[model samples]
Target chain A: MAQIRLSSISKSIDGLHTLNNVTIEAAAGESVVILGPSGCGKSTLLNILAGLIPPDEGQVIIDGQDWTNRTGRVSYMQQKDLLLPSRTILDNVSIPLVLKGTNTKKSRTLAQQHMEEFGLLGFENYYPRQLSGGMKQRAALLRTYLFASDILLLDEPFASLDAITARKMQIWLKDFAHKHSCTIIFVTHDIEEALLLANRIYVLSARPARVLKEIALDDSANSTMVKEEILSILDSETGDTYN
Target chain B: MKKFINTAKKSSALFTLGLLLLLWEKGVSWYEIPAYILPAPTQILDGLLKHHQLLIYHTSTTLLEAVAGLSLAVILALIIGFLLHNLRVLYTAVYPLLVFSQTIPLIVLAVLLPLWFGWGVLPKIIIIVLVCFFPIVISFLNGLDLVDPDQINLFRSMGATKWATFKMVKLPTALPAFFSGLRISATYSIMAAVISEWVGAQRGLGYYMTLQQKSFAIDQVLGAVVVICVLSFIMVKIVDLLNFLLMPWNRNQLVR
Candidate 1:
C-alpha cells in the first residue's frame, strides 16, 4: 500500500478558479474523507489525484515518488456505477484487467473469484440494467479494486443510492478498506457519512475550495463535537462569501 | 397493460388499412369508376399475377440497386463519421459542407448523374448514396458526442487508451442512436433508388410503372406501388433485426 500526498493543488478552468492551494494527505491503509458543500471542487480535487485531469499547480506524490499528471497509478470509482450496460456484471468487473491486456478468459476467471467477496456472486451473468443500484456500485468497486489494489479514489460512490442502501454500502466499504489495508480517499457532501466511514475527515470550503479543517478520529473523540466544529468552519466560510 | 396497449395499437393500424382498401375496392365498383383513373384492388391483383415475371425482374433490379447503395453508404458514413469525430478540425471544416450538401435537391442530381456517369446502374447508386448517407452520419456523430462524460473519465482513470475507451464505451453507447438513423436511412434508400430509376433506367419498378402509366395501365402501376411498399417495409425490418442482434442490452427498451 502506498501513501498519497497532494501538495498545494490549484486549478483554474476557463478563468474560473475551482481549487485554491488545496493540500491533502493520507498514510498507507488509512481511510480519508473529503467533505464539502456541493460544487466546491471536491470532484476536481479527486480528478487531479486520479490523474484524469492535470491541476494547474500541484505535486501528486505516492510512495515517495512524484506522480503529477500521470495516470494508471490509482483506481478511481465515480459517483455512478458506470458499468458498461452492454456487458454482463462478470464482464463489467473484468474490464480493467482486460484493458490492462489480460486475456478475456483469464480476466473473467479472476473476476469470478472475487464475486462472493463483493456480494455479487449470483449476478455474474446479469446485465447492468438487471441489478439494483447497490449491486451496481459493488460491482463498480470490484472493478476499481481490480484496477489497482494499493490506492483508491472514490467520488461520492454511494451518493446516488437510497439512504438505507447508502448506509449499508458505507459499512461494507469501511470493512473492506480495513481488511484490505488499502489507502482510500473518499469525497462526499454528506457530513454524517463522512463521520461514519472516515478515520480522518477533511472539511472543505465552498467554491475555490480550500481545506478548512482536518479532524482525526479515535474511540475517545466526540463525533458530535467534531461535526459541530466542521459545521462552524463551513458556516464561517459561507459567511465570508456573503460579506 | 402496456403490452396490451401496444398490441391494440398495432391491430388498430392493420384494421384501418384493411377498411380503407375494402372501401376503395367497393366504391370503385359501385360508382362504376373507369379503371384508367383508379383500378380496383382485384384488377391490380390480376395485373400483378399476369405480369409476375416482368414485375419480378424489375423488382430485383430496384432491390439490387437500393441494397448496394445502402451498403456502400453505411460503410462510408461509419468511416467518415468516425474520422470527423476523432479530428475536431476536420469535423469543423467538413460538417457544415455535409449539411450544405443536403440542401441541394436529390432530384436535380438524379437527372444530371446519368449525363455525367452515363445511363448505367452507377448513377442510380450515386443518387441513393446521396439520399441515405446524411442521416446515418449525423445521427452517429450525435451519439458519439453525447456519451456520458463521467463514463469517459472513469475509463481514463482506469488507464484505458483512447481506442480502448472508444471500443468499450463510446461505440456501444452510440449504437441505439446509430440504429435509429439507420432505420431512417433504410426507409429512404429504396425510395431514392426508385426515384433515380424513374429519372432514367432501362429496368426497375420505377421504369415499369412509367411504362404502365404511358399505356393507361393503372392497375399495373398500382401493382408496382404495392411492391415498392413491401420492399421498403422489408428494408426497415432488416435494420430492426440488425439492431436487435448487435445490441442485446437494448432489446428490453425496444420491447417497451
Candidate 2:
C-alpha cells in the first residue's frame, strides 16, 4: 500500500491554470474521492497524481518519495474501459503481464484464475465486442488491479455505464477495496458515490480549480444531514481565497 | 424453398455472365461481325482452348512479375512508412512529395521506365511497385496517427516501453488500415503489371494481349483479358484470406 500526497500542486495548460496550489492526500489503504463539477480539472488532478502529466508547480510524493512528471508507479484507469478491441477477454486482461515480457501461456493462466474473481469466467475467449458495457469495465478493473498492488487512480470508471450497473459496480468496488487493501484516489462528480466510497472527499471549484471544501466522513455517518451539507457547499462559491 | 432462394442468390452473378456471353454471340451473328472485329463468345473460347499452352506460359510470367513487385512494394512501403512515422522531420519534408508522386500517372511513367531500365522485366516490376505503394504508405500513416491517446497513457502507466506500446497497441490498431491498404494495392498490382507490360515484354498475359491487339485477333485479346480478370479475382481472394487469418477478432464483421 502507498500513501499519495500532493503538496501545493499547480498546473497550467496553454498558459491558463487548471489547478492552483491544491493539495490532497490519500493515506495508506484509504479510498479518497475527488468531487467537482464537470471540466473542473478533477481528472487533471488525478492525472497529476498518477504521474501521467506533471504539475507546473508542487510535488507528488508517493510514500515519502517525490515523484513528478513520472509514470508507472500507479494503476491508472481512465473514464473509459479502454479494452483492446482485437484481443479476447483473457488476452485483454493479461496485457500488463504480456507487455511486461511474461510468458503468454503463463499470463493467460494467471488471468484465467482472476477472471473468476472478476466475475468474468466463461468470457476468456470472447472478444471485447461480445461483452456488455459493465463486463468490459470489470475486465478493465481486473487488468488495472493486476498491473499494480499499491495505488490506483480511477477517473470516473463507471461514468459510461447505466445507473444500475454503476451502483452495482460501486458496491463491488467498495468490497474489492476492502479485500485488496490498496490506496485509491477516485474521481467523480456523483455526490452519493463520493459519500458511499470515500473516507475523505475533496470538493473542487470550477476552472483554475482548487479544493473548495474538504469533508471527512466517519464510517457510521450515513445521514441525510451530511448529504445536505455537501450539496450546499457545492451550490455556493468555493471557499478559496479570491484570485 | 429457402434452399432454392439461397442457391439462386449464389448463382445470380454467374447467370448474368452466361446470359451476357449468349447475347454477345447472338449479336455478333446478327451483325455479321467478322472474327477480327468482334468474335463470338465461342470463338473467344476457342482462342483460349487453342492457345492454352502459350496462354499458361505467358500468364505465369505475368504472375511472377506482379507477385514479385507486389511483395517488394509491401516490404518497402512498410519500412518506409515506419521510418516516416518515426521521423517527424523527414515525414514533414518528404510526405507531400510522395503524395504528389502518385498524381503522375503510371502509364506516363511506363514509357520512361523501359527507356531508363531497358525493355526488361525490371522496368515492369519497378513500375508496378511505384504504382501500388502509395496507397499503402498513406493508409499506414493514417492508421499509426489514429492510435488512441488514452491507450497510450494506459500503457505508459503500465511502465510499458516505447517499443512495447508500439508492439501491443500501435501495431494492432494499424492492422485494419494496413489490410484496407492491402486490398487497394491488390486491386492495383495486376493492373499496374499489365500496364507496364504494355510498354515492352517478351512473355506475359499483357504481352500476349498487345500481340493479339496488333494482329487484330480480337478473340485472342479477349481471351487474355479473361485470364487477367481471373488473376485479379484470385489476388483479392488471397488478400481476404490473409486478412481473415491475421485478424480473427474482426472475423464476424470482416466477411459481411
Candidate 3:
C-alpha cells in the first residue's frame, strides 16, 4: 500500500479554492516532489499531507489509516529554519525525541550519532544564533529526520538558502533520503530542484491551484537532460516559451 | 593583563566616590552647615556602625517583603502571560485592565492596600506585587506573542501540540524579554516595599529612616538611604547574572 494518499483533497481559504479536488499517492520510500509557481498552494498541499492543516473536504490516508484528523504520523521541515535560539544544536535536534518523552541523556546520545552525518558534530554545543543560515537549515533538517516518522514533508527547505548553498543542500538531501529509504513529499518552486530529487513531479497552477500535470522522469537520465526537460515543462505551463 | 585592567576599573570607580566625599566635606566645612541639614559621609558611616544590628533587622524585614512580593508577581505574570498568549480573546479582554491597574499611583496603592488589609507585612507585599506585576506581564506577553508565525506553523506541521510548541519553542524564545522585564520589576519591588512601609509599618528600612529623622539623627537616615541604593543595585546585578546564565546567546550579539 502507498504510505501516504491524498484522495480528492480539496481546501478553500476565504471561499476561494486552493487545492481543487487534488489526489496524489506516494509509495513507501519514494520521493515525490510537488512543483508549482509562487501562489500555487504547493506548501498548503504539503501541510495537509503532514496533517498540519485539515482539508476543507476529502481524506488524507497514511498506511491505510485516515490521518486527516489524526496527528503525529509525519514530520515536516518548513522553508525557514525554525531553530530555537536558546537551545544548543544538539538540543534542537533532540527535540522530537524529548517531545516523545525520551530521557534527556538518551535523546542527546541519539542526536549525537546523526550530528556527523549532517556535518554538525563539532557545532553541537553552539546555539542557533551562532550558526550561519545554511548551518541552521542543516540543523532543522537533522531535527526533522530525528523525529523518525514514516513520512517526511519538506516545504521548500532550501528556498531561503543562497544559490550555491542550496545546490549543495539539494545533493546532500538526495543522498540522505536514499540512504535511509525515507518516504518524502518535497515542495519547491525551482524546477531544477524538483528534477534533481523527485521520482515523480506534480506541477500546479498559479492561484486557487490545482494540479496542472504529473510527470514521471526516467530514473537513469543524466542530470543535464533531466534539468532541460523540467525547464521545458515549466515554460509550457507558464505560456512563456521564450526558451 | 586583563585582570590588572579590571582592577584598574574598580579602583577608578572608588577614586570617583572618594572625590565626591571630599567635595561634600569641603562644602560642609566651608558653609559650617548644621549636621541636621546634611551629615558628612563619615558621620553617616559612623551612625550606621553604631546602629548596625537594628539596621540589619529592618533591612532584612524589608528585603523579605520585597523578595516575597517579587516572586509572587513573577509567578502571576507568567501564568497570565501564558494564558493570554494562547488565547487571543482573553488577551484582548484583560490587556486593558492590566494597563489600567498600572496607571494607579504607587502612593495611592500603598494607602489603599493598608486600609484593605492591615498595618502589617501583607499590605506592603501586596503593594510591591501591584507595582511590579504589570511590567512583567506586558513584557512576557510581548515576548510570547512575537514568535515568528512561520516557526509556529513549522512545529504545527510536525504534529507538536500547543503545550509542546510552548515548551520547545515559545518559552525559550520568550526568556530574554521575560528577564528584561524581571530586572525592572525586581528594582521596583524593593522601592515599592520600602514606600509601603513608609505609609504604615513599625519595622523596616523605611520605618527606621522615619524613626531616625524624628530623633534628629540625620546621619542614620542618610545611612538608610545608602543601604537602599546598594540593595537595589545588588538586585539588578543578580538579574543580569541570571540573564547571562539563561540566555548566553545574547552575550555575543551585543552591538558594541
Candidate 4:
C-alpha cells in the first residue's frame, strides 16, 4: 500500500498550459477522485502521477519519497480498454504478469484465479471483441490490478460505458476498492461518480486545471447539498468566491 | 440462407467464366482463327492434356522458386521492419530506398539479375524477394504506428520494458497488416518468379512458355497462362488460410 501526493504539479505542452499548480493527495487505502470538465487535463494529471510524463514543476512524493517521473511504481488504466485484439481475455490480463518476468503458464494461472472475481470466469478463451463493453473495462481493470496492488490510477475508465453498465461498474469498483484496500486516484468528468466513489473529491477548474476545492465526505453528509455545492462551484468561473 | 447466398455467389462467378469460355470457343471456330494466333478454350485444354507431364514439371519448378523466394522475403521484411522501427536513422535512410526499388522496372531488373548472379535459382529468388518485400515491410511499419499511445503508456506503467512492449503490443497489432501485405506479396511471388524465368532459366513455366512461343505453340503458351493464374489464386487462398488460423479474433463470428 502506498500514499501519493502531487504537490504543486504544473505542466505545459508545446506552449499550451495543461495543468497549473495542481496539488492533490490520497492516503493509503483511500479512494480519491479528481473531478473536472472535459479536456481539463484530468488525464494529464494522472499521467504525471503514473510517471509517464514529468511535471514541469513540483514533485510527486509517494510515501515520503520523491518518485518524480519514474514509471512502473503504480498501476494505471486509461479510458480505453486497449486490449490487444490478437489475444484472448486470459492472455490479455496475463500480459502484466508476463511483462514483470513471470513465466507464461504461471501468469495465466494467476490471471485465471482472478477471472471469476472480475466477472470474467467462463470467457477466458474469448477475444476482446466477443466481450461486452463493461466486461472489457473489467478486464482492463483486472490487468491494471494485476500489474500492481498498492496504488491504481484510473482515468475515466468507465466514461465510455453506457449509463446502466457504468453505474453497475462504479458500485462494483467501490466494493472492490474496499476489499482490496488499495489507494485509488480516479479521474472523471462526472460529479456524481466522484461523489459516489471518493473518500475525498478534488474539483478542478477548466483548462490549466487547478484544484478549485477539496471536499471530504462522510455518511452523515447530505448528498443533495454536496452535489448542489459542487455543481455551483463547477459552473462558476475560476477566482469566484463560493461558500 | 447465408449458405445459399454463398453458393449462388460462387456459381455466379463460375457462370460468367463459363459463358466467356463458350463465346471464345464458338468465335474461334466461326471466325476460322488460326490456332497459332489465339488458341480456343478447347485447343488450350487439349494442349494442357497433351503436355500434362511437361507442364507439371515446369510448374513444380516455378512453384518451388516462388515459395522459396516468398519465404525469404517475409523473413527479410520482418528483420528490416524491426530494425527500421527501432533505428530512426536507418528508417529515414533505407525506407525511401525501398520505395525507390519499386519504381525500377522489374523487367529491367529481371534481365540484370542473371548477369550478376549467373543463370541460377538464386537470381530468380532474389528477383521475387525484391518484388514481394516492400508491401510486407510498409504494412508492418504502418501497423506498428497504428498502436494507441495510451496502450504504450499502459504497458510502461505496468513496468514493461521497451522490448516487451514491442513484443506484446506492437507486434501482435501489426500481424493483421503484415498478413494483408503477405497476401498481396504471395500473389506477386509467382509472377515475379515467372518474370525472372523469362529473363533466364533452364526450367519453369516462363522458360517453357518462351520455348513454346518460339515454335508457335500458342496453345501451350495459353496453357501456361492458365496454370499461372491458378497458382496465384492458390497462393492467395493459402495466405487467407494462414490469416484465418493466426487471427481468430479477426473472424466475424463474435460470440456477443
Q: Per model, how much of the real contact set is kept?
A: 0.78, 0.80, 0.60, 0.90
Between candidates 2 and 4, name the one with more favorable DockQ: 4
- Give the C-alpha interface root-mean-square deviation per candidate: 0.9, 1.0, 1.6, 1.1
**Can you write out model 2's per-residue Cα lDDT over B78-149, one digit (the tens) per residue?**
999889988999999999999888788777889898889988899989988997788888898899988989
Rank ordering of all candidates by lDDT, starting from the highest? 1, 4, 2, 3
lDDT per residue, candidate 4, B1-256, as tens digits?
A: 9999988987997989999999999999999999999989999999999999999999999999999999999999999999999899999999899888888988998999899999989999999999899989999999889998888888887778889889888998899889989999999999999989988899999999999999999999999999999999999999988888877888874221
Q: In model 1, which residue pairs have backbone atoms overlapping below 3 Å?
A: none
- Name the runs in model 2 displaced over 4 angstroms: A238-243
Q: TM-scores, in order shown? A: 0.96, 0.96, 0.89, 0.96
Tens-digit per-residue lDDT, B5-99, candidate 3? 98888799788989999999889878988889998887889988999999999999999999999999999999999899888899889888889
For model 2 the local lDDT of residue A242 reads: 26
Per-candidate DockQ vs. reference: 0.80, 0.76, 0.56, 0.82
Provide the lDDT at B30 for model 2: 96
| Candidate 1 lDDT tens digits, A126-145 | 99999999999999999999
lDDT of each: 0.91, 0.87, 0.85, 0.91
lDDT of 2 at B201: 79
Give RMSD to native, each candidate.
2.2, 2.6, 3.1, 2.4
